[model samples]
Target: MTVDLERAAPAAPPAPPRRESRIWLVATAVTAVTVLLIVYPLGRTVLGVFGIGADSTVGRIGEVLTSGETWRLALNTVIAVSVGSVVALMIGAVFAWINERTDARMGFAARMLPLMPMFVPSIASAIGWVFLASPKAGVLNGWLRDVGGWFGLEMVEGPLNIYSWPGLIFAYVLFLTPYAYLTISSGLQSLDPALEEASRDAGAGALATFRRITLPSLRPALGASVLVTVTMGVAIFSIPLVIGTPADIDVLPVRIVHMMTHSYPGDIGGALGLSLLVVAAVGGCWLVQRRMLAANAHATITGRSSAEAAVTLGRWKWVARSAMLLFLLLTSVLPLAGLVLVSLQGFWSAEVRWGHLTFDNYRYLVDNELVWAGLRNSLVLAVVCASVAMAVGVLVTLVLARRRGRVASTVDAIVKVPSTLTHIVVALSFIVAFAGPPFDLAGTYLLLAMAYVVLYVPQATFYATAAYHQVGPQLSEASAVSGAGDGTTVRRILLPLMAPGLIAGWSLVFVLMTGDITASSMLAGTHTPVVGFVILDMWTAAGYPKLAALGVLMTLVSSAVVLLVMTLRDKLLVVR
Candidate 1:
């Protein structure tokens, strides 16, 4: 008995060192990756901004500061973002109030329908809007002109120019409203109904009750939604590129693209400088938002509150439902239908003739070898990036969960840094860092995949962390007591428990990567084709029919993949 006890004690001492070794190995590996992917690229870009001599970095910064075009582009970006954010806030607030607070018709459908617009890629939405409302050959504009002519008014050829500032703002609002709705609606749903009921019992009118109680209760959520919408407005690339370029309107993002691609010898230095400014502006906004959230931490809902009682709209309910339906029509159904219609037409024109329609666009896409290659590239990039991100996310979560030192905290902060930067900025950094020297990986699918991984790893880590928190440490402790190694415990216990979260993170990253435009446009070359790049090329060449057809194909493929992943996730949860 004494000999056996001594042998078991020796076994326990070795187990701890083995576990410590594995933890150190994983933490070091994750830190190295973060440095390579995030730190090195960003550092290189910042350093490149301070070159020497006639091509001096200081001179470039001075030139950018002195240039009127730079200020003009900045002004245009601010105006568009401000206008779009305001419109989105109003629309989103109303929709959330109606869906969550009021007794509106088809309450469930009203809430679900808004999410449809989210699934349609912003690039696709831009293409669809162009078809429906372009100044020259817009179907709706032409129809409006005809209707006005019947009243003896000589209407303009096409009055709804989708290429103008108003048009751009409209598109931005449509895309951003869903975010506002989701955020505000979540806040409204969580509010304790007793306060609102108490106000009503005191003879307060509906508007008064809302102003004094409901709106104040949702202030934090409203602030957050506003920050998100405005930040997105500034960072958005696809909408501005598609709509602003045709109208000769240049926002900062489009200007960055032009500088990097169109200028003689390419003004890469100027582009990087501009990107730094944008990042600073976005960072400032994020800081302000965080401060606001921290300052306003009052709890409106107690844990004892039951299901929220919906406000009865009475005769106004029909009007509310009509308004909701109209929003859905303008933002979702119309754009989608316009894309389908334009895909069938020989050319985008006001007049629709069945005889002029053909399947040639679809055939062209199907028969083109280049298009096939692009499709394959897109699929492979999405799958590989998502899978790799998930794997990395697991390692990151483990390191974060086990360690609490300053080094661990610093690593956490560095991992989250990329999430705050826009996609365009991240892509520009990659170009400046990896396009030359020891890593001449520009214009390659490998570089493109790396960009996707960097952009999305933070998101996957977020999901994984949440999932990890759901699992208790007791299981791991029990496994350790049973003499299982760290690797064995993770494989047998943690992984099986965290499978659902891993799958969810994978699906989200997959969908985001597949629909991504900014990185694809910035990184892809003739040899490394992607769907977003293909669509942009087609749009520039005025191949509207082919662009629409490609948009439709991408939508279908991404939607199917999302559905499959969701189904798999559901099955995994059920098994667990």
Candidate 2:
């Protein structure tokens, strides 16, 4: 019976039949759409940057780089970015270390608080800082003045100027520290805990152990933090536009926008030219970092963690815990408090007394033309942009996953290019690409939405790719065996599993888009003044109280929306 079992049956060979025209038709349609959406804008923009038209726009690029004024703007941008990034890294690293080493109830909250700023729009945070730190009518200054008045000390001067370089730094640090923390925190979590214990058991002092064992081990993450912070800090435009503008500090991005919009006959050539140069410079650093990452000898670990390294703080445990809590409170709670105080005031700058504080600012916000319009525009744009970006995310992720070699690598590089360049450059590039070209999407919500998709697609794609890789081909193969079609398998199986990553990606896009100022400044039509631009207009018009009011309104709206999303994700999309 055992010898003859295989002779009873013979398997049929698979039949080769006619190929479906529908498959080719669908593939062509997808390729056409991809070319139109991804390739066209980028290609047209590059050509416009090189002055492809009879107007000879290409020469402007050389002129922009050679100009002295452009140099100064570049210098200023470098300084601001450099300083703000240093501060962010130091803050993030210290807090992350504390959270890792200290045993305290507040450790979780410490990590969460740093992440709080990432949830708010950069523009909103700028407004909040202004409310708290403004020289003339800031809540902190008011408090200092009232106390000083009783003591006969001069606390409030002619104007309390926080809208300077320091102001910009504070705002940027508030916004970007969280990014550093999260990235480095993950890095810290990946290292083996036994290494620290081994060092201690070898008679190494805690300080020595940290310096030799922990810090050295964390070098990769530290480098990543520096690179991430520097790139992002330089590219940041919104924080500068809101905080640096009042003091007339012209960073490169701001200068580019000014040249394009306010200059004679709209110096589109010069702006695009400058944008091309700036994009090259910033994008170059990003590329170098990517190369370093690509060339790394050691493999990095990233996955779901059941355990995290926790160092015994011993005598310094309390001290470490206190410092972490204090830092979190100062960064997150204080800035938010400032926004609250300003929102309650009728006139945030003119009066320095509690008697002047009223619910009038909040009341005025509801009825104000600018506030209403800005809120409507911001919500609409964020929703539209997030949707478009998520859709692009799905397509890009699929391509990268299915073809995971040079295609994935190339897409990763190109997609991240916009994030490295300042938003002003992107806006300018769009202007050049769409204003007069074979495809002009200027002055439309479509342009802004597309810009957002380009800006955020990198995050979505990277996260989605990781999710897709984690899922692997086994499940898809099983589905095929069960007679499931490609589209059906992807829709019913792949997308559901990608929910968490997609949610995270969409949240990042939402955060950046809602806070955006640079791109919106160029693309926002008369009918659509986004919240970021509205804040800029109000601040420039010297409407401090109104700006504060608007900031409060936007903060509440953003916090509510984010919370709702998290709740839904936890309940419905529990892929994690």
Candidate 3:
């Protein structure tokens, strides 16, 4: 009398062997492309370094490893990164704790603090600092000199030099702080408040409870933040190029750049050597963090609301608020004011002649052939690369989400390969890989675009994965039942639902590419001038006003593009 529903239901046919084979072949092809894109550049460089034609190059590796200059490079790099990471972590963690837990929150403004670097290019920020803190012409120095005059402490030069070690480290910290804040703040939001309440019930003070419970719980965040800060500091070229180069405080990235660009015959050998060292260091940190994460360095309770009563700071609340304001001023207000004033000054000078300020620099931006070309190239490159990368990311994410087994595993591993490398290292590898021989793509938009896609694919994939997971699978299943194939379902249902996220990912890459200097520094040339290259050219020509104006223009253009993408996404979603 059993219903036997399983037997009564019609059996679904298994996937055909030819279709399955085609799927495998497609996955293999995708894997091959991913490997070629991510690995070929770096592998080509290393192979060239050790090949027969590279006898001198291989020998130079030993020379570089054994020399006093190399030691100074390593030592200086370590000191800068170590100090910068700690200071950045402290400032960022303090900001996160205050904003997330204390009564000093500033609502939406506080949330935007971590996104400081996205639009405000680090190169622009560093140049602004140079104009603000240069020994002779720094505006801040001028103000200090005027202040010191009242106290009769007269001096012609600075008590502050942005060309010094402090200056270099300060520049690094400014960029790194936001990274630390983001990770730590996310950790703070995820922690369970019940544990802290228990600690309070046990008669522990706020500080004591935090030390015992919160700090230990946040080790994962702290460790990840430090890793990011140190790696980024090591790979940073702008601070070192703008500040360290003049100060004679050489770091690895600047050293790499010098070997490639400063000499008539570029020291390709030496640059490759340093790049490998950076790769090793970054790879080691990534591996260590991965293991730590796997081993459960810390754990947090999830699926509960993170809203908790703000801890009263008593009279200290005002101090916390003041700290937030100071952060805002340092990271945003002062740097922006410096750029604005310098652009108006027409030349680099301490005294801002309000009446003499002109719009000639702005005019130059509009009129100059090379500058205008560079701006246009950067914009086009950003848009095109973002579109292509998002397309690839979505395709890869779909494969991983919908399929299973060895192919998926291979694809996942291949996609994450770029995450272990620093951008400048990857940029250098691209130069070595394609600047000669069969592939001679150097100085072309295709070359820069390929390098950008490689450098940012990991990020794109991560964002795409998040987007895929956000939508339910039931929608796709329903569409299949209603006779939609994979392509039709993706085109009609998935794309619309995924538009906002995909566009957001696009905006991130667009912003980065439009203002990018690391890759552009190595790969961009006269034929394929980009905003970053022009900015560097301005630096060399002593055209401070034009430099500032161009930087401001680049930032504004990037912001506009991001806003436009978002607007289009909204309209498209509404239309669909």
Q: Give the best candidate by lDDT.
A: 1
> How well is each residue in 435-542 modelled by candidate 2, as lDDT tens digits?
665666666777777777777766766677777776788998999799977778778888888777677677767777887777777777666678866776776774
Which residue pairs does candidate 3 place in steric collision? none
Q: Is candidate 1 or 3 superior in lDDT?
A: 1
Off by more than 4 A, model 2: 1-38, 101-108, 148-152, 156-161, 205-220, 287-296, 300-309, 350-356, 470-472, 573-576
Using lDDT as the yardstick, the better of models 1 and 2 is 1
Q: Supply every candidate's count of residue pairs whose N, Cα or C atoms clash at under 3 angstroms.
A: 0, 4, 0
Model 3 poorest 10 in a row by lDDT: 18-27
Per-model TM-score, in order, reads 0.87, 0.86, 0.90
Whose TM-score is higher: candidate 1's or candidate 3's? Answer: 3
Output candidate 3 Cα RMSD. 3.6
Clashing pairs in 2: 50-58, 51-58, 135-160, 434-440
| Global lDDT of model 2 | 0.70
Query: What are the RMSD figures for all models against the true structure?
Result: 5.1, 4.2, 3.6
Supply the global lDDT for candidate 1: 0.81
Better of 2 and 3 by lDDT: 3
